[model samples]
Target: MSIAAGGFTVMEAEDDYVEYVPVAKRRALEAQKILQRKGKSSSLEEDPEKAKLAEAKPSLLVKATQLKRDQPEISPTEQMVQQEKEMIEHLSDRKTLMSVRELAKGITYSEPLLTGWKPPLPIRRMSRKQCDLIRKQWHIIVDGEDILPPIKNFKDMRFPDPILKMLKAKGIVQPTPIQVQGLPVVLAGRDMIGIAFTGSGKTLVFVLPMIMVALQEEMMMPIAHGEGPFGLIVCPSRELARQTYEVIEQFLVPMREAGYPELRALLCIGGVDMRSQVEVVRKGVHIVVATPGRLKDMLAKKKMNLDNCRYLTLDEADRLVDLGFEDDIREVFDHFKAQRQTLLFSATMPTKIQNFARSALVKPITVNVGRAGAANLDVIQEVEYVKQEAKIVYLLECLQKTPPPVLIFCENKADVDDIHEYLLLKGVEAVAIHGGKDQEEREYAISSFKAGKKDVLVATDVASKGLDFPDIQHVINYDMPAEIENYVHRIGRTGRCGKTGIATTFINKNQSETTLLDLKHLLQEAKQRIPPVLAELNDPMEDIEAIASASGVKGCAYCGGLGHRIRDCPKLEHQKSMQIASSRRDYFGSGGYRGEI
Candidate 1:
């Protein structure tokens, strides 16, 4: 007997009993038959009524219609106009949202995607209102063809997300005016000269750009330790360099990760072990913050090269020049490639600085935070005409009334030591530093002062510039500097970061006579109150305008005298003779004064 399957037959066993197939095999055979039927079903003719019924069946989706159609039978033209109005309103909302997002991200909108829609204008479209705003709000001066990009906040500057996160963590939410205006100029690959008060966030102006440039370069071509650093920041002092290095490291935290190649910044300053610096530098560095002396030494010793340096910045540039590093600065500049970007920052723009800038920078954008040589208005300054012998007593009295974190500046190392010893003897914790001290000693003194382990710091002019101690309540000029510029820097040590501070200067006729006229002018310019003696000593001839007005003659502006043009002024001739005599005196003094009595 045989059991018939679909197009096949299964014969029974020889015992005449039925032999069942496995369950799986039976199901497989059934599936094959179903697939055959399905394949052949299309070819076989179907009923037209069934096809019509299948086609008539609809999905669960409902047809769309106007919701208010039941209310009224409106004209087609009116409906078209209403729909157009609604579409326009929707488009306007979308455009507004897009504009806000772009503005926040410091991005300009692209051309419109739709046929009828127009692209929004730039939010920073430099209008007359914005120009007036900048002029009125800041003492910004632009010399190049490019207009500065205005920033209302850090968000408007469009810093990287990592940087922004770091800034937020550091509690820095807004960009200072200088940072806002100057960072854009630096990032634009142009040389810039930034003049702002000491605590106006000038460090970050170049720091942000340096980090951004490094990150961008790293992404494109991985930075290697062998090729040298991509950024070089030159500061006037070792402490300033170290401070800048710390700030860079703080900003670099988010860029370096656990498993990634580290982004390194090295401080190649003196006082530290050179071998350790050389070792780390051999490994690689993305940035280098260094002093002129140490950096020049490294360059001479062939430890570093500037061929790969794309960005160079000078902090406290005027001080650097005043420190007599002009030749060294020029030598370092020679090492850099011509295509490198140079940025200079100073508290004041003097003739020497202007000349150096003209030679060193290429079409630099000048960013002045306040007046070019203006002092911090936040500082309350007073002058005391103490006799030279009475300064210590006066200083002791001032210290009795003032708070800690006070900085005392002297003229020489001996004065620094004397003041420090005097303060120590008087039961005041004090530390002193000067150029004469060893590097380790200077470092210890500064560290002690910064850690609040010492209440007072006595130092020469070496400590006057670029050392940022945040909570200094007072700056005491134990001995006034001969140049008024140095005086400006000295007093600036106290009033920083918008904090109210007091600066007291000890002035006397014998010691401060050379600077008395200039000091009076500076104090007046800063709007500080003068003592009776200082006010009495004010030179009438110093004010060219006042003297000229009083003289009632349109005399030479240079000399402020009658019957002399600027070119033919007797004072000019006298000044020329004095300069010649001074140069001769210097020459003879250096030559041991051959014919001196």
Candidate 2:
């Protein structure tokens, strides 16, 4: 017997074989046969009647009109390729022109520092006495040579029209004290150490100048791939870094819409994928806002460079040193290939930070808006002796004292979570963020709180430094922090941007006497009502001026605490003990003499 399957003949017998084809192949063959039959039927010469019927009905396999052979249809992928090729050619021409300009100027493409930069004539023409009167009125103390006169109006700065418009849009009619003195110094390409209270618009002091610097560089020569970041802002925390990055973007957007050259800014922080940041760098960026850890990692990995980064800003410099990011920050300085303009802005100026600034900055100007580490006068401070066990329960009453968008700060991550959970269970709209939470969760909580979707935000010290929350009515310290600086920052969150705010701190006996004394002094300095518990704790540094003059440094020179002198600073002792323990550990690792051994 013989059998045929899919056009292949086979013999089925004692020594015969049969063959079969795949179902898909067989179906395709059947479809081809059908198409052949349809083609034969569709021929007008073969069947005129059927052809007329086909013309009346739409044919499935054939088109009524033929496509022109002169112009072929291009696939989406091919079109993209053509466009990319044209872009590459255009970029090449621009690069050639840039190279020629660089050669003529005897400078390299990576170095974009604008030498001999000067402020507008209006600023330069102001006499020293006039500058003094303005600074005195604003309570601004500037220590530097050839200080530029402070601009009373934003217009006097001679900023681009778009920036002025943006200022107007943001409802910032006049510059703050820091912006008044700090802006002119930085704009003049001078290194500066800016000391101002929290919520004093310090961010804008550096941010606006950074934008201007980036714009100047971009206009002079476009940034090529992996070539720039003319401006660099290093913040202590990821939240602060993101905030600064957003501010830069906010300014950049208007400039771009106003038909200015496109300037790119990137946020390089931990918890975000480094690949995305690397991709952005590979393209190019005009400004970079970053935290120390991630920025150091990127530089160490050679994924980014500061070759053209002439403008460097350190926001919350004291906090950066306190968080032990000082080494990472100094290491970053080693990566800069050229002389850079350094700016350090912080609410508190500790001895460590001052020493660090002296070593890092060159001929730096000191712009002090107020006494360093002093409480913000704009904030009304309230101290209550609430028991530690009853704080969570009393949190409800505190929330009521303020309107929506209140910040509750705790010393520990566990407290933040507990407070957050308790609030949620009690039907309070709240969000919590801490170092232990995932980055996405932290970002979500912050965003939700900022967007006014949540009434209260429970957070640790992570939100304390440099995270601006506009219109924050109150800041409640659930637990008094051990460090006075932390207390200052926690309260600073509410009283920001020239707005009056209230800060209520819950204190108990568990808090060290030193901390209590510091808080007492802070409250007294701000002229807030001090409770009996704090009032009874006698101030040890009654003759502070004498001590300050004797020590040649104001406050506790070691820790920047106003309540105690350097000799009595608990923080200094703790640091010394920590160093001793660390040394012991190293000695043990080196097989030194041990009692157990």
Top model number, TM-score:
2
Off by over 4 Å in 2: 1-115, 543-545, 580-597
TM-score of each: 0.71, 0.78
List the global CA lDDT of all models. Answer: 0.70, 0.81
Candidate 2 overall lDDT versus native: 0.81
TM-score (C-alpha) between model 2 and the true structure: 0.78
Model 2 clashes, total count: 0
Residue 569 lDDT (model 2): 74
Give a tens-digit lDDT track for model 1, residues 72-118: 88655455445534533442343221123233555532221111211
